[model samples]
Target: MTTSSNSSLSDVEPSKTPKNILLLAIGSMGDVLPFVNLGVGFRRHGHNVIIAANTRFRSFVEEKGFAFREVNWDMQHEWENTDAGSPFMFDFLKQGFQKSYSNSESVLNNVDFVVLGTGAAYMYPECLFRNVPAAYVCFYPWASSKSYTGAAYGRSFDSLQWLPFQLNVKIWKTIDQVATFWSDVGLLPIYNQRLKELGLPPAERLPWLPGGAFEKNQIPVIHALNRNLIQIQKNPLNPLEIQMDYPSLNIKEELKDFVPPHDLVEFLSRGRRPIYFGYGSMHSFSDAESRVLIWLEVMSLLPQNQRALFSDVGNIKMKELDDAIKSGRVFIIDHIPHSWLFPQTCCVVHHGGSGTTHSVVRAGVPSVVVPHFADQPWWASILHRLGVAPNTGIQANAITTDKLFSALLEVLSSEEIQEKAAKIGSKIKKEQKRSPVSKIVAYIEKYWEKTKWDVLTLDDEQQKVKVKDNWRQVNGNCYGNRMMNGNDDMQDVYL
Candidate 1:
């Protein structure tokens, strides 16, 4: 076939910019940063991005070079203030759901697509109810054959035997029921107030993600984490891996010129490959004094050759660190980007957060996991079984130097643990190049090309799974009911 020379030589622009995309998350730097990396990816690919998250991250989002859209999910703030104070945590979940519902339109207005983390997926059904096309983007797999969150927190974490498929169905039904109650009553009012403040319309319930309103089988998901260790392999791209080419934040260079508070720099420089001791946004200590005491206790347990860098992310005052802040063995700083800090450390002493876990594992350093609650414990268990760290997850309130020291020593002195960590680190170094955002963009592009911009949603048959009420019967209401105790006046945040 012959073609005209002018047609062959004509310059053509790339596809039109993708309609607005809604990016959502909750809590600290962990929940937010990965999405920012994603937003950077979308922008490079000619997509407009808007972030829907708690207001606390507004400055951090802007700083990272992305546009920020605020949502009224204040659970992290409430948790930080009240030590997650029982019912407060329950209410926080409720409020987050309500806000997610109320903010749907704002999130969907003129939106061509959506990408969300684990926290955002809980609200995905509502987007479907609103008839918005969406995809679930995870840094980690949600459906591992091993103890995934849906199975573990579903009251089956300890069972030695694999759960029957029917049993798994029942487990999720109970969780959805418990979750719905929290969303409807416990948190809706908070959501309403936030919407009023923002001058955005309140969210109304809609069909859930990729199913119900959308086709179940047509659902598109982009799982960002490395595939080798992931237990489940359901997606089209199992072991989905991509080359990551993120621009460096260069935070170290920026911080190098600015003089840190007295003794901070000297202490950081003086440590003999010190372990970092901070819980990110989660508070392991209730009061500054107690936090300081914990620092002193942890420091006392470590040999003088090793030191501890305490991050005050929860607003932990250095004064509470007391003498340790001046002890030349301890350094307290407000924040340091994990991307820059993890590579330099000999070991990481952390709260077992998923993001932190991924960072340290990628750095290939051994860890001392002091998991407090939730998925942190689950991650801690995985690391311990893998021989990457010693299990140090005592109740955050009960941690003492003796307990802390025992866990820290195992990682620091044991060649086996160090070797294992180094091995995992080598694997992570290879996997880090597999960028989650790029894979997601690729999925979207392929979908767009196949559908010719016609949005596709999941179908019902794909969504259908056997329901096992018996699973709930065995678990005995795993999420026992508790009401929020709002007037608990004790308020403090510790790093």
Candidate 2:
């Protein structure tokens, strides 16, 4: 198999013992799992690893033999407690922002490095100010042009989709201003002073930076994503590439008993080819009753020959499952590891969370995505565009039994969809060439070994000079670029 340069990074020998690592993701298990894998890989290589996330997964994390720090981001409770469903979802995000800021205040100063996901990085301003070296890992390909967040966070409606880029810039500008304002209020005016010292224009208002802009401010950032897939036409500042690849549970057969619901054997034996339909962590269907009715209606339309598994884990009550059970081909399960369950499935229907999207795709199953809010729609759009699935609008509410049935048939019946899915699956397999854990570990080792804490300083003038000299030598070795090189050199000097 042909391997890319990124895959080769992990193979480099380390020159020093690795440092303790902290990974903070305050979302669902899907949001936290890949980092978990990375942490596990770190520990395996003899570094201490700690994961901070929602308490819901505390037991799961400890059971995996890792330290679990609780993040009181009550995402689920916020939804359930909200008076209005859809609009209250905005409050839900605000609540998320608050919790993330608080969590960062508590942990940023202590960690050697931090790696965060999207909603998680909303707290990044804290880490950044704390002088912590950090990485932002966007699990999915970006679609928007926002400076920090990509189109992945924007609305799916074509009209509103363009708004994130425009709005986010103003919002980030505001956040920067807020940071400057808070600096005047508190003794830590270092960041604000630095802005002034650099002779940059003062921000109009407080920057909508993650975390209250209190703390140290000297962190270097490493973005981790696939650059090609990021939206460029939509947002011009799209060169950032962060690490991709979701973490695998790597749960062995022996560990099956430790997984939830206490009915492991029965869950596994239910069927070898059950289609899975469960939104990971985030619940898109606020109208539980309508969602259940739609789910029932859609399941009824699927061919009797096809078996499926439904997890109304966050919505529909267990007692309301009379119809779901009557459909002999469908099994209603509470929870099962998607990593394990997806491969046995003929196909999947899901809320396209980045983690779930990659897991199912890695399993090589043709799937359908009925997105529910936020990034899910972006995933649905991409997967639909990729032809492995039909983008059947947002949530089951927008999809009728006819729509659902057609989508199901489209993936299951179409040999073309199956072929395309297999082709995409092969590409994903190639993409997972090297484990992210190893690459991250290698990066840490190299950076630490060379300068130790000296690398912490923002100054790299000497290194910059050496890099320029080496580039000049390399240019001299290559043919016919003296004039063009002179232009680039002049531009670099001007910049």
Candidate 3:
């Protein structure tokens, strides 16, 4: 492992040129796709970029013409086999972390820099020990900031602005406890033991703790949501949190020579702009059939002039939908790029995965977000807050045919909703002078330069103190007053 001398940001140049970059990402297609897009951008900028992810995504990664390293965990299999309510879910996550860390160690010796997703950021201590410059790229907000409640706790807080600073802190700490339960049981001991073997000090705790990784490392944290979509807040907490445009990979040019299914094309061409329904990689519902039934019922409620398209990626079993298929009212698609398909749709209905939410926003189509789990509800709230989707999007566990029908009807019938979505979409398109991928690459380059010579490193204790100080500064003035007063303008604050 290389060690850096204590120096300032401008003085510590290990190299003058960009080095071979290793991008580590894990999770659903939503998590992996943006990194793939970033890898393409890096490659275009003459950097040797390689993506390390689950073994299942090897073909997907290689198809994009980048080197791929298998991380040896299949999230789909884990999701399918493990019961949602079971404690073994943590064990599944633990196994994934272990394998990803091991795989990352095997490859890091050859890489000069690293880009990690929030799931993979736990390896930052390892990167620090190796003196490898690393930064985190997130699809959603991960770090705790006064600008917004942490995305992990988005479901818990009804109105963050109404809560006091201490209460908000307690909310985050409680969330940390739940996350810590998983880490302490599955990852911490193993990681610490390995650190001992490597002759490096063990981490005090998991990095996901507030002020743990983001502040401790002080690395550039890139958030890939459109700036326009993120509600701006006064005195935002984290100076490290950088907002970049969501990277929507241009698959259209690549798919131009390719052909889409004739049935799908014909269905779209014939319908009065069909509504799209897809729960990408989400299968957590206890009653899959019931959910499908509700969707079918919602479709039945629609006028004969309106149509619906469903992506059969998640728990929706298509064989059981033979009746709907034969009736030609609902079309089941295997896998299609939202970039290509969403533009043709009148509206989209989906589990609010970050990737899917951005696609709907980019497509400028009004949506009914039926969130299944984890950050989906948060994205749903953002959509609703932006007026692109109806308020209080149908929760997965609470979803009913009536709720679906009503939400769909409201979006489809509201010219204001349609217009709002289109305006937001147009604004996003206008800001696409550089792709989100390019912006990410540029940020990484800037990070490399800024950190190459920095000597002002903070130890764990100092980092914790700094975090407290920063929080105090944010909560001391008008920000705290507005939050405590339950000001209506609080909702307008950007995160």
Candidate 4:
């Protein structure tokens, strides 16, 4: 709908042929937001884009005026209580998957290709069933080899870094298999059952990444990251993967101007820039006690004249935080674009999520990372390794008030850290001109070539098939597409 005057995707126009691209964006707000960013990229490139995600995000996706399909996964609950149950609980995850596939007559009817997020790999069989080629995308690496791996590998194998490279690779890959052991166990039976129903052969087991189905087949697997900022341990033996700069809002989406609330604007107009603290979507009731204690200490520790902003209010109310907010010592915000807010911050202290890490760097400010789990610790280490953050960072479970205060002070005062962050930020801003999304789109179009026919008809097909027609009253909402069963998965293909 709008474009930045210096848009990169505009520089290299999309091919004459437009595609209908379906994306699997299943996870928390942090996880699903990137896919929304990418979906808009495809839309700008003249393709029909559909985002399939959790029902919670239906309105979030539909607000962009794109067709949304629902597929359920309580990622937050899983992260909150890791020891409680499998993410693929039979009664929960299985039913959601089965319903989506049964409803595929709508979303998959004319979808040319899909971009699979890590959690949505189970949808591979459905893609295969519908004869659609799919690519893999993530904030971090996906397959494992002696050379490259997901950040979880590094966190699990950091102690054995002194071992031989190949041996370390084996350890990390083995750890990956072990880490995913439960998920693989839970997913295989359900996955195979779906494949059987599709008349496809059952898979023996899950691959580290769909058994390298996408990469080995030359379907691109993209890591939307800056290789320059994070030194990913590399090996040629790993499956071929492309590393690109993180997708930027102004560059990729050219989204409408961000308008901060008048009160937030007043807060910003103050002479001193505020410190930002956002723990992302990792809010867990299990750790809420400790999380609250840490916040209480943090609020009390805010320097006398300095300001701070928190993403949202903590669940168990804190008198110190409450008083601080009431007195304008802190501000609570929701849905403010990081691209707009980060530049105004003096510095950021946040959970080391993939998006927030890059956002901090791109904002050209120093940071203090408080990593919780998964790829988080690795990101903290990466920021330290790059001299953009103070140290390997304080883990959330292990964090102490003193350690946090020291880390914050270091990031705030260290000229070296600020300089490095700014330089990387400037470099990343310049390199975004390369347009990773363009490269991704080009690879799909060039390798997975389809004919130039209208939506229903493919050139040279034995039969000219007309797909289920438009506007099928989706779950009491007129979303201009077939609705999902019970208002979850869209009954029709995403555009």
Alpha-carbon lDDT, every model: 0.54, 0.53, 0.67, 0.63
lDDT of 3 by residue, 151-209 (tens): 66336223344778657645554444455455455767766665565455555455544
Candidates ranked by TM-score, best first? Answer: 3, 4, 1, 2
Please say which candidate is ahead in TM-score: 1 or 4.
4
Instruction: Indicate the TM-score of model 1.
Output: 0.70
Would you give me the overall lDDT of model 4?
0.63
Question: Alpha-carbon error at 210 in model 4, in Å?
Answer: 7.9
Candidate 4 lDDT tens digits, 1-495: 001122123234335567788988766777788778777678877889998877788998998778897664555554565532232344555655665566666656678778887666667666654556677677775434455344743362243557876676666655555545555566667777876676555554443243333422334456678777654443222233456556555533443655569999999997588888778786553266566566557657867777888775556577766787787778877668887888889788887888888888888888888877667777887788788888876877677888887888787788998899889888877877665556666654543443222333333232212111110111122321111112322111111
Regions of model 2 farther than 4 Å from truth: 1-15, 79-105, 128-130, 141-149, 157-243, 249-272, 284-289, 314-320, 323-327, 430-434, 444-451, 454-495
lDDT of model 2 at position 25: 72
Question: Quick one: how many clashes does candidate 1 have?
Answer: 18
lDDT for residue 182 in candidate 2, whole number 0-100: 45
Whole-model alpha-carbon lDDT for candidate 2:
0.53
Q: After the best TM-score superposition of candidate 4, give how far the Cα of residue 164 lies from its true spot, in angstroms.
A: 9.1
Model 1 Cα lDDT, one tens digit per residue, 182-256: 544555465445434433333322112211211122444554544433343342211122222222222333244
| TM-score, per-candidate, Cα-based | 0.70, 0.67, 0.79, 0.78
TM-score of candidate 2 against the unseen true structure = 0.67
